[model samples]
Target: MAVERNIKCVVAYDGTKYQGWQRLKNSDHTIQGKIEHVLSKMTNEKIEVMGSGRTDAGVHARWQVFNFHTRCQKSTKNMMDYMNQYLPEDIGVCQVEDVDLRFHSRFHAKKKTYIYRIWIGEYPPVFERKYVHVVTETLHLQKMKEAALLFIGEHDFQGFCSRKVKKSTVRKINHVQLKQEGHELTISVTGNGFLYNMVRIMVGTLIDIGKGTLTKETITEALDTKDRSKAGERAPAKGLILHDVSY
Candidate 1:
């Protein structure tokens, strides 16, 4: 009988160039496609990896979790080293562990945290260009904080989600906070799950509030109305990052 095994891995990637996490027939620049390519080459067998969630194109990840089943008897270290050799420089496998066959990275995740970075100065530092969003206007941190507070708790975030989402828009937000370090502003949000473009939309709404484009009351009204147009625009994907996921 063939031995079955499962492996869980923590992955990080600079998603500046990739099309996203999922694989597409004609796209060769997806994170999943790159990882699966390296794994297939190393094991000489095709394998499908299950990611904790799908991140949109140009969205970076700091602690994305994924799992795959394998029949190889190699040690985790050996596999990790071999995979690194074949994987691109932008992607890194932080850790790997042997797991039971029943482990599913996506379904078992309890919470996910995402961070959106904005540079609130005239220009961003050259070194941080790929990771941060540059905003020329001065932001009102107090108003942004007030808007973020309204996002906490369960709500039907239909207004914040993009039209492409096929699933229900109801989601529970555990925490939402806005902080600033010099010219760098960070919006961190933790939740059970998020709808398509939800995080970006939230960030945009906060930004609109800070810029005096939208008021805090508008957030509650948008949520209550479930009107997509009432919310602010979706922020750029380059500013969003998957900070972590807890299982």
Candidate 2:
């Protein structure tokens, strides 16, 4: 029997040109699809890469992890080099290593961190327009900080999720840290797991608090009622990035 080598890689992508991470029959312009295409071409065989989770279209990723099994005997360094050479400029393999066959990127991940960047200055971010979401509205940073605390701890985040979901909505958030550097408001969330659009909705609700549109109590109401309409608007995907993932 031929041996199957399991390889894991850390990838960084702009996500501006691709449809998303997951491969779909409806569209072939996905991050996963693109990676598979390059790797398959080099290995002269079909390859399927599995990611930790699917990020929405236009969402950037700093360090996304994926795994795939191939019979090719190339060294890890060679594979990584070939990947960077063949993949598009927007997508790059930062690191690659061989792992046990049992290593599953999605199931083995312990925590994931996502950062949402909001540009608050009057002058729109010309260079970072595709990377950050520009909002000119005046924001009360102190009030937003207080509202962000509501997302900590475990809860049924039904209201925070916008996508139609069949799985349980219960997830635990370790912390939501907000920082301001110059005109950029960076919201970072570290969680055990997140439902679809959970972090974005939470950030949206915090923006509401900054604008004095929603009180801190609104978050409690949304969680208790389990109604999506009660939650704040979902932020744009362009502002969100998969900052990191830990196993």
lDDT (10s digit) by residue, model 1, range 1-247: 4588899999999999999999999999999999999887776679899999999999999999999988877899998998788889999999999998999999999999999999988765688889988888878999889788899999999988887466778899999988899889999999999888999999998888999989998899889998889999889999999999998
For each candidate, the alpha-carbon lDDT, in order, equals 0.91, 0.91
lDDT of 2: 0.91
Total backbone collisions for each predicted model: 0, 0
Q: Which ten residues in a row have the lowest lDDT in candidate 1?
A: 161-170
RMSD of each: 1.1, 1.1
- The Cα error of candidate 1 at residue 167, in Å, is 3.2
Error of 1 at 221 (Å): 1.8
After TM-score superposition, what is the CA distance of residue 235 in candidate 2 from its true location, in Å?
A: 0.7
